[model samples]
Target chain A: MALGTDYAQQDCSLARALEVVGERWSMLIVRDAFYGVRRFNDFLAHLDIPRAVLTGRLRSLVAAGVLDKEPYQQSPVRYGYGLTSAGRELWLPIYALARWGERHASDGGARTVFSHATCGTRLDIVGSCPTCCVLVAPEDVMMRPGPGALTELRQDPVSRALGRPHRLLAPIEPLSETVGEQAAEPVG
Target chain B: MALGTDYAQQDCSLARALEVVGERWSMLIVRDAFYGVRRFNDFLAHLDIPRAVLTGRLRSLVAAGVLDKEPYQQSPVRYGYGLTSAGRELWLPIYALARWGERHASDGGARTVFSHATCGTRLDIVGSCPTCCVLVAPEDVMMRPGPGALTELRQDPVSRALGRPHRLLAPIEPLSETVGEQAAEPVG
Candidate 1:
């Protein structure tokens, strides 16, 4: 599909998605939080990100509800960051990408292997039945749009993604029919 | 475990992973490319990223072998991008993260949906068995150092990740191995 213009000018679902989480360091911060790195210092130590960048990312994430900032200690103590339910849920995508990078990006030697904690069999992020050994493809899945989608924003990207074929990480279906027509209109 | 240091500087797998793809807009750029976005202007239209930023990101992705740049049309002599075998493999992690985001970040009402072209069922990125409906957890997965790992690079992140307990998104195994050694050193 052709990339349309005025992405910033449009209020579309993908755009909305990008607006919140698309900035630099956002996902990494979320990824670090999931790995049990709870403090700002831990994020810095783990990410090699500049302090300003980390701080900005953290603030944005908290504002976006991806993270919950709580006080871990008091007096001379400090606040620790943790994933809210929202943050915790990002595990799948992070794992999926990490597994992909490990499998494809490495220099031909196995860089890392993922195993099933229970079965002891190496796990595949996109595998079907470790026993049956089927690989899952995007077209095999469906997706439904989420809440942050524009109420009155309908644009090409959203239309094409919603109506036609696109490579999605998983299967998604639009949950709300009300979103269809109303979302297509331009939002002030 | 801690959050306040240069993680990239430390001997950590997550840090190394970040070094490769941790910069802002990188993964998303990869994601859009997979969605079939091919041109510079298209990415800008789709991502709302600054033109310079888009150029830089695309260049980095190409350099990393995550994307390939070729001429889409010779009339205007415009270039287009497509995934190499290496790029397509990123689907694993992209799916993982998208699933995580949809489950955790999405409100109960789906804003959109994805249909697996293979299964004909709406699939979640959770690595669950559709037939059995079992959810797979990170603890359920394990990673063994792979072939690409450079044993000669004693301080490599992959080496460190293989050495410790880490989630798919963030590898924390190096802390005890690397930091423990640091802690043991004489504190002059």
Candidate 2:
């Protein structure tokens, strides 16, 4: 089933936002970016998305100013994707939606837990720090695998690396240079 | 252009949430439900969405427990759709995404402004009541056309009725009972 990318008739701002981030795998890609999964291989490994779909989504995100591509290596012209300020502003919506899923959709507890890096207070359902009484920014939050997280999830290196607590927006270490090279070309 | 509906390999809660509401027109339908457009024709008129798409999305939502369909007219067995508790919990994410679009995507100001119904203080970007320093629930939020709202938008009855200030989750007056009957069937 073909879904149109643009909501031509709707004048709502939500419609506009959807135009940018509302594709099938787009939001999940953004979630991975927040988790500091920058390189193409990491996203591919963690998401298991088709290479062509990942390439198209990354291109669209970069064009929409949600993610910026910059060269990380000089010789082969390998680039890493990072979220722009506009993209970082999406944290609230992403967090809120994930919280909703944890409460209403997930049978077990949250698969991931977020806490205020400074106070270590777990964020509430609305992404607010109860102890600080403030909405925690993505930069100020840390994520850790929760009780509901599957113990033996994926065998991918990126999935393994994500098991430990990490601050949001900090880069996840790439598994290897060869993995990036292998992921450079989009496969059918 | 066939986008698969499920992210089977992704183990994230956000993926789970998207599995439920991440379709092309699903979030917009949820947005209309928040605006209290209960009847099928009202949604069809206001959204300008294909009747088939609306029907499919609504059915999906009901199946996901985001909406419930109940009898509104008995003679012909007509039904009206309303958001369930699980659906109402989506307000935070919806508001956050709309706010992000208004700030980064819109050229003019907001098309809609949400305020704390009690204190009449405009909600902050994160949907928090600045005056009370509390998060406002959808029930207690008031919505009105903002400065950037186009003077003359759609000519549909639902669009015209939405021009004035209305409380979220309060039903919008149906244009006509007959409109419901006309839209009862889903078109291919």
Candidate 3:
């Protein structure tokens, strides 16, 4: 709660939650992981964070039990970061907050619309499947651009891949290392 | 979004939402508003924020339409901040995120518990009343110290008032000016 304290002094659960994800780019990093961006390179390409900050966030998330760091490649020892079961519980808050943004944050337009993967019915304001009348888990949800979708706003490989309709939590295979470098390269 | 960017460059609603409330202390300010701590002194007493920082957050929240700045005392012209409709919608995310913390962030015990003011049924993970089978709005929710609550952690008047069961959005009348100063005094 203090300028230097990580809100540890507050005896509130919200304070505890914010201590974990309230860092500048931490929530966005968690959002990226939910979008199935597992590799560090892919997250870097999709987000505009510096490499060092991204590294710290990933390490912190892993340490907090929100993300699991696993090796996906042996030739170069590449690592993939995915949400743990506890981390996956974060989907509710993430979706609820993101949907709040969709309704009130931007102009009266939706950028990404979420739907029930099984029935294809769009979720309600709180991520509940109106047709099924139950809250839909992230794995059972699907995402795609909506009325405010800007396909060309970002040309990064991860962004391009995200422009398509995809099931939440399913890994979006990151492009090859060469293509990834090209996308991450400074445009200037 | 870029580092300098308030996530304005992103086409997503989540980015827009973050732009308004992602700054440190913003969400906590809003949380206090939901708990009926409206006056500047009450907020200052409840939160461990510097005076200038709290002032800035209040102004920004007013500019963003999350809080309304209204004159409550006219002799010296004191103002009170209350949540607007848009701000009230934040309860979904705030409550959900806090529940997530109660589950994963702390030692398996809840510091605070929320329930439907009408039925007294505890809210589900998503802020839904299991008995009523509907999402409980902020005004309909009641908060109380749970089994894990540490009542002595904070003795501020605002915190003491919050220690008792209270409804969301009802004002917690602040102590008189002299009592406020006594509580705000720095300990030797």
Candidate 4:
């Protein structure tokens, strides 16, 4: 569907915003950033995306100011990507859409569970902690695979690292240097 | 940019959700439905979308059960599209995304202002009525043009109808049968 990239002359903010992040794989890239996948290779590995496509999405995101790239490894000049404050603001929509997906598109269970990091309470559908009685920001949320998570499909280190609870926005520390990209075995 | 229509193996609820609504004009079409757009011509006029493209999107949405199609005119058997229960659930993501767009995509001011119909208070970025201390549902919300609205871009009846404060999800009644699809003049 060669629907043009921009919703030109729409006179709508959602249309304008869609021009920025509505491209395919763009929102998923943002979701990976929230899940702590930072390096270009990690995103490529976990998302099964074409390397050039990943490169373009990252470049577009950085240009849109939704992401900021900085040098993490100086030897080869490797850059790591992280959400800017503006990008972080996307958490609400991400959560809402994910929750909607879980409700309508799921095979039956949560793939990952999110909780308030402060008190360890699961967030409600609208993203408020029932126990804390407050909205849980992505930075303060902890994530782990849930019962409905398909544990057998992927074996990437980034996917393995997400198998356990981790803080949102924190860089995912791979299990070990010895564990190759496909070293991890499927637990299912 | 031939990103395939589906995320083949990504294991996330968000990924599953994106497969359904992440297409180029899919979300915008859904947004239009929420804004009380029904009938084929109205969507075509209001959206500036190709007729064939509109037909495919509406079909896809209906197949996914995000929208329901029914006959509103018996003589010609013309169909009207509206959000299903599952479709109405998309309000959260739409609101969240639109709010994000209002924050980041705007040139300067709001193009449309959303408010809680009960108290008449503008909704917060998260779609909550601060006055009522509750999340405002689409059925109970009202929408009207705002300071930044570019009134001159299009003069279709749907656009003209949206100019006034109106309730979300109610079928938009065209001003008159005499108003041809392009009968109205630009507000600017």
lDDT of every predicted structure (CA atoms):
0.50, 0.84, 0.83, 0.86
Per-residue lDDT of model 1, residues B1-188, tens digit only:
22321233322233344445656567667766655556676567556677987887788778878888898668879887777767766655555555454444443433233333333344445545364465433223333332222333333333233333223323232342366543333222
TM-score of chain B of each: 0.60, 0.89, 0.88, 0.91
Per-residue error for B35 in candidate 2, Å, reads: 0.3
Q: Which prediction has more favorable TM-score, 3 or 4?
A: 4
Question: What digit string (tens of lDDT, one per residue) describes model 4 on residues A1-188?
Answer: 33436788688888878887899889999999999888988999999898998999999999999999998778779889999999999999999999898889888689888899999998988788999888888999999898889877888878888877889999884553455465556465
Off by over 4 Å in 2: A1-4, A174-188, B1-4, B175-188
Residue pairs in clash, model 2: none
Give Cα distance to truth, residue B164, candidate 3, Å. 0.8
Give TM per candidate: 0.54, 0.90, 0.91, 0.93
Candidate 3 stretches greater than 4 Å from native: A1-5, A174-188, B1-5, B174-188
Evaluate residue B168 in candidate 1 and report its C-alpha lDDT on the 0 to 100 scale.
37
Off by over 4 Å in 4: A1-4, A174-188, B1-4, B176-188
> Which is the winner by lDDT between candidate 3 and candidate 4?
4
Q: lDDT of model 3 at residue B148?
A: 85
Clashes (N, CA, C under 3 Å) per candidate: 71, 0, 1, 0
Provide per-model DockQ scores: 0.10, 0.63, 0.61, 0.76
Clash pairs, model 4 backbone? none
**Shift of residue A81 alpha carbon in model 1, Å:** 2.2
lDDT by residue (A1-188, candidate 3, tens digit) is 33322886578899888878877778888888888889888888788778998998888889989999999879988889999998999988888888888787777588999999999999987788999998899999899889888776887767776777778888876443344433444333
Against the hidden true structure, what lDDT does model 4 obtain?
0.86
lDDT of 4 by residue, B52-85 (tens): 9899989999999999999878977888999999
Candidate 1: residue B123 lDDT (0-100): 43
